[model samples]
Target: MKEHPEGGTAAALLADPRIRRRLPTAGTALGAGLAVWLLGGWRLGLTVAVLVVIGDVVRRSRKTSSVTAWQKSSAAERRTEKQLKSLQRNGYVVLHARAVPRDDDGVSDGRIDHLVIGPSGVYAIDSEKWDKRLPVRTMSHLKLFHGPFNKKDRLDEARWEAQQASSILAARCGFEVPVQPSVAIYGPSIPWKVMRVRDVDVYAGNRARAYLRRRPKILTEGDVERIFEAAQQALPPKYPD
Candidate 1:
């Protein structure tokens, strides 16, 4: 199993120039507020100080939310990657954070959380770190609801991503590569061991490995290599050398 480097989304967000710019602006506001509080009249100074503090608080809140989301996503990716590692001894090739093009124009839609190629077939896995506070409820027509948020479309998106991966591999290998879409729900209180919605597998974090392991073998050793090669060629490198 070839291990592709992780830290794609989190690293990109951290290295973003916009974040660097915001830090200095926030610092300037904090310093100016302190100066006003020390030299100006108490009433006016207090007002300015309070306003600045509120602004800073809001800014920090947004930043913290982004960081927290990234942390959760990174953690989920690591957990799933660890589980997938056990498959290497069984002739599975795993690729992490593989970018799949969603359009014919060559623009990437998003990166597949994990791509697994083995004797069973190809899989395009999407790892989700959903809030565990709210229980996921399935309504009519397999509609999913978490808290107040409707998550039914997530399965559709994952299926589209898998189809895109299959198309890419098929074009490269001259044969249809059936890519199965799976959503590994981490940090969620899922009711079922494995839930299938629109043919997409939705399973809890702990059961991801077992769910994948249960897949029937469909490809040979040579087929795995061929599809893996095609994947490497089609997807972008997770990290730059």
Candidate 2:
């Protein structure tokens, strides 16, 4: 079970090893070798194992590194969902970890985390699960961190997601609708100032529900319901049935 109901349950299912489907168990890669040594010979088995290992390595090399902003964001979304349940008594819906459609630029891509399609315009909550202090300047792409940090946020990744989602949604509905972008932070001592980054809302995962409550509704209950229904139909196949 997910920590919270809503979308988190689905997200947890996708992340589960028992439930999640891997591409394959190298069956195709070792099929030829296994066929050649169907007599269960030890030497054939060793050869098959080696071939499988090589195939696995080659597959790994072909794949883009798993370290991505979207993967990192999902971690934050999980934390935020738990926090949302604590703070909001009612009037908020959670979709958990449903992956969004891929954008033009191929990447891991994010699911519309914890969709808050309330009276406010549809909010595509993006999670940022981070630790340590960050010295972010106003209207700048670079974020300074402590302890000899060498990594930085990728360029236009968040914006690209928001824009892509908005365009796809608008096209689907035959109406121009704005999708709000938010960053949910799951970290110790999250600074208040960072929440106001370039007028884009950022909040600690724990504060998400409360933070949302303070904002005016951009969509009505009916509108929220419509978006929710549409989202369910549009979720990727990896999501729960």
Candidate 3:
């Protein structure tokens, strides 16, 4: 099977030394405890078995939480990547998991989930896996509600990432590069396929390709190549060696 980019949440988790080291200990404990229960008497055997089971349960619980988080993040990214690949087939230049440096110390910051340049425009896309059970509700003043919780700030973060991309491209190209901010929401029960909030375009993961495809053409092929090259130079490498 093809591997996801190294920067992906799931990939990073699986590659973590700590997680890798701890996961095997649980299985070893279970096996050892089972062997001791068979060889030793009921009293000592039961106590050892119970203690090992409890320790294993706690360890597994922590690992399960990390795995669940990675699954959600990886699923969202994978969904967005599939849609972006469709855009590429239609002549879009797409970049996945582009990490940019923070302004404070030039250290690597979070990645832009996807970056696309094509006839429509340049887009800095972020993918999110929100709760599937809760219905997304758009409120007044560009706010978004899910059940009783407010989640308007996610849009703000997407817009900021777009701005960061725009700034990087503009600096590279010596002119303004209008990068649209977009959020591809996965695992959310969205009423509509697409929703626009001020400057950010929000859409369900499956509909993101169509949403971009339907946009008005703003860049030519030459512009797309130039912008893609500039992005490649400005953004950090997508994967480590």
Candidate 4:
């Protein structure tokens, strides 16, 4: 197995606030301009440019809030990485914002913030960086605080992504591949909770990696490799060609 880099580097890159904000916005603007020029006229291109600038400005204003969220998600991922490293010190993979299998919506919906598929089993982790205590319940649907408002839908989306991916794998491989969805909160403000729903485990910032490591084995070495290859092919590039 190839050796993997330290979790700190991946975490730092993941935590880097600019990639998510600046690079994508720039790329989108460029793409829009190119499309407008090729198919439409200068007027359409100019309009796109104007919208791009406006979008950038709006994003700049929201950078602080976005950065805060990024930090939390990265923390949980790094925690999960620590355990994955133990299982296979090297060759353990961590893919961030990987789109769900077979996405045609055009929008990158239901991203697996941190996906670790190793000798143990496949883990679909959702990182939540929010303030306030989350109440633990046996039921999956529950409201959690979100600043001035309460947002329960934040982490549910991740779980749904995991489910969809699991179904895709099962159909492709002719076996029920278990995709364990876990919620890892990364913030001092949010209180801890331990809950289970439809086999998905809900946990807080603390012990997230440990929790993932404890999951039952669903794929062997070969099976893991096959799934990883499939996911790699399905993953969208961070940068454009």
TM-score of each: 0.66, 0.55, 0.65, 0.53
Using TM-score as the measure, name the better of candidate 2 and candidate 4. Answer: 2
Model 2 Cα shift for residue 74 (angstroms): 6.9
Residue-by-residue lDDT tens digits, candidate 1, 151-229? 8678777888898889889999999999999889887698888777778888888777897786778898999999999
- RMSD, one per candidate, in order: 12.9, 14.9, 11.6, 16.7
| C-alpha-based local distance difference test score of model 3 | 0.74
Single out the weakest 10-residue window by summed lDDT for candidate 3.
64-73
Residue-pair clashes per candidate, as listed?
A: 0, 13, 0, 0
Ranking by lDDT: 1, 3, 4, 2
TM for candidate 2 is 0.55
Candidate 2's error at 56, in angstroms? 37
Scored by lDDT, model 4 comes in at: 0.62
TM-score of 4: 0.53
Best candidate (score: lDDT): 1
Query: Can you write out model 3's per-residue Cα lDDT over 37-109, one digit (the tens) per residue?
Result: 7888666766775687688766544333112333333767766666676677677988877766544433224
Once model 1 is optimally superposed onto the true structure by TM-score, how far is the C-alpha of residue 165 displaced, in angstroms?
Answer: 0.4
lDDT of 1 at 168: 87
70-170 per-residue lDDT for model 2 (tens digits): 23334555456656555334455556556666656554365555555566566666666656465422335244332355323322345455666667666
TM-score-wise, the better of 1 and 2 is: 1
lDDT (C-alpha, whole model) for all candidates:
0.77, 0.56, 0.74, 0.62
